[model samples]
Target: MNKPVPPPRLRMALIGCGQIADAHLQEAAKVDSVEVVAVCDMHMDLAKQAAARFRVPGIYDNLDRMLAEAKPDVVHITTPAHTHGPLTMKALAAGCHVYVEKPFTLDAIEAETVIAAAESAEKKLCIGHDQLFDPTWLDCRSRIAAGQIGHVRHIESTLGYPISGQFGAVVAGDPRHWVRQLPGGLFQNTISHPLYRILDLLPDLHPRVEARWDRTKYDFPTELWVQLRGAEITGSLTFSSSVYAQRVTRVYGDQGMLEVDFDAQTIRRHTAPKLPGAFGRLEMPFRQWREGARNLQRNLWRFLKCEIHYFSGMRNLMAEFYRSIQQDTEQPITNAEMLRVTRIMDEIFADCRSREERVEEFVPETRELEVVR
Candidate 1:
C-alpha cells in the first residue's frame, strides 16, 4: 500500500454553542492544524453568537445542514449528555472524526453504539475527559508507576463546586435546567471529570461499587459519593455542589499518600508518618510555606512561557485527537476506557435509583457487562 499523506489541515465544525463550546473553541484556537469552519446550534442566536465571537466562517442552526455543507474533517460534539449518542453516530457516519464532551452518553449501550459506529467508519473518537491530559495528573501517574508512592491501594477524588457560583446560580434559578433533568441529576454532568481519572489508575473489569446521592442544602441531590472496589485497588469519587470550591485527589499507597490539587497544579507527597508530633507540628508551617512558594513559581513560569492556558488539558486533548486522525494513530482516550466510565456511572445511577423513588428509571444492569471490542 502506498504511504498515506497527512492532510495539510483538518476542517472542524462544532455543535452546541453553550458555555463549554467556548472552551473548545478557545483550545482549538491554540492548536495549529484545526480550522473552525462552522458552528451549529438548535438556536440560531447561539450559532450566530459563537460565529461572531470565534470568527467562524459558517453558521447553521441545524447539524445535518452544517455537516453536509462544511464537510468538516472533525466534528466537536458539545451538546447535552442525552444528545451525545445520536450526534456522535451521525458524525461518525459522515466519516468525520469525533471529539465529544464527557458523560460520553446517557448509558453504556449508547456508548457501545457510538464506538461501533466509529470502528465501522474507520474514524477516531475522543472523549472530553481532559483531566487525564493534565500535567499534574500525568506527573502523579508517572510517580506511581515509578513506585514513588508504593503499591497503589486506594484513591479519593473530591470535586467541590459552589452551587451559587456563576454557573450554578444560573442553573439553580431555572427549574427546567438541563442538568436537573439528567438521569444521575447533578452528578451526570460533573462526575465523569473525576471518574475518568480514577478509572485510569484502577481498571477493574468486574469492580464492586457502593454509592450515595442526597441533597442536604440544595434543592436537588447536589452531593454524590461513589466507591469502586477492585481486587487489587479501590477508588472513590466525591462530588459536591455545596462545598467550598476545590478539586483534589488523594492516592493512598503503601509507602505514603500523594495529594494532587488540580486547580493549583500541585502535587505533594506525605511519606510514612515518621516525624514526632511536636516536631512535625513545628515544621508543618514552614513546609507548607515552601510548597506554596514553589507552586507559585512553577505556575508563574509556565504562564510566562505560554505553557499555561485555561482548559489547557482540553486543548492538549483536542490537539492529540487531530494528530491521531492525521497520523492514523491510536486515540488519546480509548473507547474501552470510555465505555468503562459510562458503565461505572450506570451502576451508580442504578444503585441510587433502587434506593430512592427513581428505581426502574435507570437502564438495565446488563449494559454494565459489555465486553471490550
Candidate 2:
C-alpha cells in the first residue's frame, strides 16, 4: 500500500513589522501547516530586519504591492489598533484569510463592517485572543465542562500593566503615539485580553455596563474598573498600571470556585472543606498548599516536555486556525463573540468619558471660588 501525501502548507504574509509582529511570526513558524512568505511595513528598515531575521523571501514597503506580488493565502495584521479595520477589509477583499490582533477595531461598528467584509469574501477571520486557548485555561474549561465548578455565577478578571515597562513606557512617553489616539487609550489596547474571557462565559452579548476611569499613577487614566451584568452571570474587570504586573481571572460557581493565574500558568480550585466545623476551617490552608504544590509540579512537567512558554497559547491558536482553513471548518473564535467584546468596550469607554466631563464641570467652579477667596 502507498502512503498518502500531505496537503500543501498555507502561504502567509505578515503586515506591520512592529514589536508584536515578531511574536506572530515566531508562533506561526511552529505551525507546520503554515509558511510565512512575505513581511511588510511602512518602514523599509523594519520590513528588511523582519525578513532577514525570519528568513522570509518577500519584503515590501507597500501593502498593495505585497498582497499582489506575494499572493499569500493568509494575512496576519499585527499593526496598531487604529489601522486594524481598514487593513483587515483590504486583506479580505484580496481573498485572504485574516488573523488580526486585538482590539479587533476601534469600536463595535468597525468590527461589524470588517466582519461583514470577511463574510462577503468567504474567508475565515480570527482575533488574537490567544489567552483563551492557553493550556491552563483549556484545563479550566474542561473541569468546568465536567461540572467541577457548577453553574458559574460570576467572573473577575484583572490585568496589571507597568507603565515603566517596555511597551507601556513607549505609550506613556509619546503623547502622539498611535495607542493614545484610541478611544479608551491604553485600556483599549489591552483590556481585550481580559474582556473576551468574560464574553465567552456570558449567556448573551448585551450586558449592562458600569465603569469608573481614574488616573492615579500617570497623567493618562491608568486605572479602570468595569462591571458587566448579564442575565445570570456578572463580571468585573480591573486594569491597573501602578500595581505589580499580573494577569488573573477568578470564576465563582455554586459548587466551587476557580482562580487562574495567566502569568504563573496555575489554577487553584476551592470547594467546601472536607472536615466538619473548626477542623474543616483549619484544613483549608492545607488544601491551598497542596494545590500550589500541584501547580508547581504541573509546570515542571510541562517544562520537561518542552511544552511551556509564554506564547504557547498563540502557537496553539495559530495551528487551530490553519487546520480550520485547510479542513474548511469553523474558525475557533466566532464573529459574534468578537463583536460582543468590542461592543462592551465601547459602552465602558463612553461611560468613563461622561464621568470625566462631569468632573471637569465641577472642578472649574471650585477653582473659581478659590480665586475669589
Those runs of model 2 whose alpha carbons end farther than 4 Å from true positions after fitting are 368-373
TM-score of each: 0.90, 0.97
Best-fitting candidate, scored by TM-score: 2
lDDT of 2 by residue, 1-373 (tens): 9888777999999999999999998888899999999999999999999999999999999999999999999999999999999999999999999999998999999999999999888999999999999999899888889899899999999999989899999999999988888999999999998888877777666889999899975778999999999999999999998899999998899999999999999999999898999999889999999999999999999999998889888999999999999999999998888888888999999999999999998998999999999
Candidate 1 per-residue lDDT, tens place, 69-109, comes to 99999999999888999999999888899999988998998
* Stretches > 4 Å off in candidate 1: 1-7, 273-289, 357-373
Candidate 1 accuracy as lDDT: 0.87
TM-score of predicted structure 1: 0.90
lDDT for position 26 in model 1: 84
User: What value does the lDDT take at residue 21 in candidate 1?
Assistant: 98
Candidate 1 C-alpha error for residue 43, in Å:
1.3
